[model samples]
Target: MNEWERLRHAMRATERPDAVLDLATVMREGRRLRTRRRVAGAGAATLAAGIAAVVVLVAVDASGSGGTAPTERPPPVAVAPPSVGVSPTSPEPTPPPTVARDVPPPKALGQVIDSGVRYGTDQRVYYLVRVSVPGAPKVTVGLAAGRRSPNGYLTTDLLVNDVEGADRSAGFHQIGYDERSSTTPVPTFGYFVGPAQRIIGTVDGQQVDARLARWSFDKNVVIFWFDPAELAPGKRLDGIIARDASGRRL
Candidate 1:
């Protein structure tokens, strides 16, 4: 479609295959435009709005794809299997660490649910999970806030050391499963774990649980929803979750 057509569809949250974002490149690619400062300013505004609008549209479109890589490298989305999955060939094994150092609770819990990075019972490595809201549309807004490995890579929540008690959890090398919509040990909406901030102390008289030590840089937000579906095989919500004192996702 043409630029006007693409922009209109984007505003309406429609999907466009083979969509290119470089307008200047597009002009250079085949089209042309005025070189005046005033013209450039007008062009930039259109580009900014188009980019912003495309984010929500593309995010909405991609949401149907389901389950993303279960790592902190990128944000998480709740995609189902038959799409995203673990490879048949497992990765090389890594050693586990003990629990994270215990950190005192934050003063208040807002929207963010941070589980501070701490070594578990054997210096098990771990990462802080961050949640945006109770019923995030896709997967929970997750972040990786844990010990940097020898190679300087942050440990994704897959490492077994931190999740040793959570049954046979794969360590950092393992891929992550989007669980924003997945059921938790408790009946809840969306959730996250990390150090404390904005999400802390926002809601009054609220009870928080399963809090994590939340860091500022490692923050993610999700607009989620909750469902009361029965337990699914190969799926379980068993683990040690730390929450803010007020019971919210960081």
Candidate 2:
């Protein structure tokens, strides 16, 4: 067929509704043609370079056959692995909280809750717990006039041991009450003087049951707490009499 007729027939075929065309196909064809030309050009250039290199190598080989070719070669390039920065490790898991343990009660009654001898006072004021027969008349034995609470309220109910028996050079101190107790016990003539110890008081030549403990509020000072309720209902709450670890009365 003639070129004009063939062209007319191809156009009629492309004009059919099912034979759709778009700009994207045209652009893709253009890019493919350009890429092929570029590749062909590069291949021709490479061939020329290879031919030139071969000619130079032949000349060198003919010239060097009378001697020796240099054995030195360039070192191979090192390819490193893909780098990945290390993320900081998550913070250590938080630790659990601590729990408090239970403490046991004392075994002996009238045991000195706490006591200490200070050398600087003649008539020193010491905290004490006083206990005796319920109906027996209470006597003031060198008891202090009054000790106000820390909150500035005059404590009329404060039980103290007024030490009148000590000489001018020394004084004794103690406490036999738990300040944290819900119900207050009757103030007795006793105070904390040690961690745990026995207080031996004879009544009718028999031993009394009293317990004493020292609650350390800090390193330098401690409060004394005591329990005499374990004493026989009929047994008198004989005031706690403190003594040194050597068994000598303080």
Best-fitting candidate, scored by lDDT: 2
* CA RMSD (A), model 2: 42.6
lDDT of 2 by residue, 99-120 (tens): 1112122122221222222113
Clashes of each: 72, 24
Candidate topping TM-score:
2
* Model 2 bad stretches (over 4 Å): 1-157, 161-189, 192-196, 215-226, 232-240, 246-250
Candidate 1 ranges with C-alpha deviation above 4 Å: 1-12, 15-18, 22-116, 120-147, 158-197, 200-206, 209-250
Candidate 1, 84-175: lDDT as tens digits: 11111212222222222222222212323222223332121233343333332222223232333444333332211122122111112112
Question: For each candidate, what is the lDDT?
Answer: 0.30, 0.34
